[model samples]
Target: MSTSVLQWNLFLLVSSRKEFFYMDIELPASLKLTLSIVNSIPIIISMFGFLGNGKVIHLLGFHIEKNPFTTCTLNLSIADFGVFTSFLHTIGYIDQVDTIVYIYLLVTYFFLFMYNTGQYLLTAISMERCVSVIFPLWHRCHRPPHFSTLVCATIWITSFLLTVICIIIVIFRVTTKPLFYLLLMNAILCLPLMTVSTLVLFIKVCFRSQQRNKGKALTAILLALLFFLFLAFPFTFYVSYCYYFPHLHSLMLIGFGCSSVNSSINPIIYFLVGRRGRKSPSRVSMRAAISRVFKDVGDCTEDKKSRTESKVMI
Candidate 1:
């Protein structure tokens, strides 16, 4: 009887352990499915918009006068797609997920890296606009479309290389301390560049008050900087904490979720704030103005016909 009781207790313990492992696996799969659905919606919407407009061509093919806003939207869409796809492959399919995750991780990281570079590219576009507005002669002479294209290409290439290096580092399972150090270095570098771009924009606004449009431009750039700061800081903090305390791995995972929110927030910011037009003509007012112009033209033609009839009567 004593042996039977001991055997029963061991069996229960083993069953409980298996149940716990299964629960752990299922919970993450559920979460990943939820997250993928949420992330995928915006990506799908953006893709539809990109295709509905002619923006898809500019993104996939080379064009001399590539629309900057469309290009930015494309980059954002691609990044979100990568994030969603990676999450699905890595988190949703856990049993055979490792190899898929590795590949998807590289894909996701490449998109993120490119998105960051695209942010800088946007800053460059904004600065170019400001310079063109303020110094038309100089901008006309120096800012060639081909040069801009080359710069964008270089930015994409460099970003891809950097991301590849990071992926390699991750694959090798580099020490946490080194990863933390690397993240810190990147954050440090990004901060100064973001700050300088912000400061330059501010000075342009303050000194070039003649160009009253600077306010909107300044606000857009500042919003981009804020998005970067918000997205990056939590991830950096989590990484630092993980480096110091290995037991807080769960917190690091949560922090990663917070960081991922940045990918979604960025395009939202651009769509909402960056796309606003000048206040002079509201949509309604613009339509009314067009109607009035057509009405006046009709009236003028009628008047001319009536005068011609009167002259013929005379």
Candidate 2:
């Protein structure tokens, strides 16, 4: 859709040229009040997420041994921060006197990029865990230096490029059909892979006796992925609704907020798991949590590798 088409749509939506997307969105007084109260959460959560993830990343880099897993996590933190910053922009625009639809489009795609990046990283994390366990010898011997880093770079670049394309789509005002197909492609490409990988990881964690009682790392991953799925499900649902039931389009504030909360809550989950079953104060608390999660699972893998005929890398 071109600017002219959007302008026409805008004109059709409201006689006053200034009114944009949300102006026509019907909301009950109760819903409005709910939104007003709930709207304040993302910023606070985003702020805390940024600081907490920063601390975790710092600890990982300087104190903990770098690995494929840690590298993916570092990228996850960066992506979460990107989502946070995008939320900040979105809230800034939505709270304004006159919200420009174009700003919304840009911020929406930014959020999409961050969200998609996280999805890929989640898939990578699961596959990495699976690979490490299933192919310990080959993984220890054959995996190349900086290979994981390259994979992370590819994930980031792919997501960023798709985001740019999305932005271009909106900025150029492409037609409704193209928009639907783009979103449909996302539904097809991203969500199913996420579900399958999560399921596979969960199975590997649960049914494999060797993995049982291994540190709580898998437990933590399962929890984060489940909680994130609960919160993030609505956005995918909404995308389909937009394509199939266009006339029924409604921006459910609570659902959108929950999706943002997925990113905001991750650092906290990492902190909790890192510090799980411990009691300590401020600075001392974070002192070694980074090493613990990595090392707990490390001991389990080490025990298994102890019996292997092939030599393993340190």
Candidate 3:
């Protein structure tokens, strides 16, 4: 039967790969060419990603004043930069998959580590905004000054550890179970938290609040979160699924391209949102525009305290 023939071919294919993690299944010439082209696009996109996120990093890391939201933004930019740089490995290996398969696998997981960290930071940013909006007075008065710094540090360390474990498992030919569960856990934890928190912020700021200045920082957060959900989440979910079911690994190129765009677009989102309401087309500098975004959000939170103190004095 045709089914029996297909089973035999599958068995022979797996047997020859030797390295289970490599999963070197054969591809048609046209399909290979398509994947090669797809993979090359991310390499090109990484240039723009580097420039955009680099400016963000330079601005937030040095020039901008330290605040909780700015702390998260700085870390997210670093993670985005990491993802962009990791794509550089694809430069020489687009058509050939024989010799550097192990290196390829390591770089792939590294990309995941960087991207997962971004997702965690995004969730944190959203939740912080939501809480500040929902409980403005308490958040303003009692929230710890170093909270965002602590959270971002923890996320980077944890993601790095998990990624090391994943690479080790892949190297040693252990079961792929850990990779699947890690991805699954990220999906379970990050996706829902980001969704709910974003929704809360949107409803409260856009519809319920009477305030005229809802803050461009929050607008930037909403745009970044939506981009991740639509553009990046698909690749995350797909790669996780493919790890469990190796036959579906052919779409890796397409997924990376999608995620590359997601990583590349955040800087533009910040610039556009930050530039809102500015009448002068050429007067606003990048630093000025970005400063307004974070400054406006800080003002929103601190304005109540200032007003209260003035009332008491009066």
Candidate 4:
């Protein structure tokens, strides 16, 4: 959901033959303490995300809704749970955790899995959005119902399998190509899809009067994507460039810290946007509100299931 800039804390570890040792870079004492406090902020947001998304999932139950938008949002919420919890461990709280060598590496690898899975998932959502806008008829008529689920499954499985394989390689003294590829994959996959999503939104949806109903809704999504792109830029650049100038590591950490702000802001967006007045049609549930916003120009079917059940207070 945050479009996942990994903690960049991997640079903080050294995999020795028997064990992985930590190499702490000493920033100023005040800076470290400030970071610790700042770092705790995401946990609050993460909790909100977990519960907020959890509520949406509960409303849907075992049934998959017709909206791929809801499907992607659900997956994103699941990823957020992983992102938030794993994220907590990598922050200033690291020293407090039990750090048995293999255990620590497993945790590290799991964090990698969650973060990258989220990033890939966001890209998947972007690609889907692009297709929905560009070829609405095809999306509604020909697109497989399970396509979003499949995309989510692909992201999760690939992220997990690749992370485990890469961790095994790192732990057993194999080539570092896995790590290289991990960074490369993160850098490459997201931007193109996001760019297309944004371009398509601005070009086709933003200015068109016929799309008025979906405009606010689509704009909400686009704003989030744009914010993520803005936040992701320096961090992505640092991930590539830090290989040469290691001093940039600190800057990356700062960039990472700023990037985490997205986690906090996201749930706020949903809550704020989903809010409704006393006399409004219904209390805004994420699914119903989004489905309402995205009600297409030509399609007549509204997601009435969500609209009727939309008693969710926030």
Go through the candidates in order and give the clash count of each: 0, 4, 0, 0
Which lDDT tens digits does candidate 4 get at residues 1-314?
11122233432344323333643334466655666665566666566656665655554445434465666666766765665566655553444333433444555567567667766777777777777778866665566756778888888888888888887776676764465567677778677778878888777655686845555546656766776677754555665665556555566665554445554445445545444322564666666654454344213224333433574533
Evaluated against the true structure, the overall lDDT of model 1 is 0.47
1 versus 3: better lDDT goes to: 3
Q: Is candidate 1 or candidate 3 better by TM-score?
A: 3
**Candidate 3 on 215-306: residue-level lDDT in tens?**
67778888888888888888766666555565654455456667889999988988887777878846878888888888866675467558
Query: How do the predictions measure up, each by TM-score?
Result: 0.55, 0.74, 0.82, 0.74
- Candidate 3 matches the true fold with a TM-score of 0.82
Taking the tens digit of each residue's C-alpha lDDT, what string does model 2 give over 1-314? 11112222332333223334556444366644654565566667767767876777687777777666678878887887777777666555443424465555556566678888887787677666667656767776667757779999999998888767755554455543433465567667766765765786687777766644354566566766777677876666664564454444343344456666787676666656667666562443664655666675556445545745354443
> Residue pairs in steric clash, candidate 3?
none
Ranking by lDDT: 3, 2, 4, 1
Any idea how many clashes model 1 has? 0
Worst 10 residues of 4 by lDDT: 1-10
Error of 2 at 295 (Å): 2.5
lDDT of the candidates, in the order given:
0.47, 0.63, 0.73, 0.58
Candidate number achieving the greatest TM-score relative to the actual structure = 3
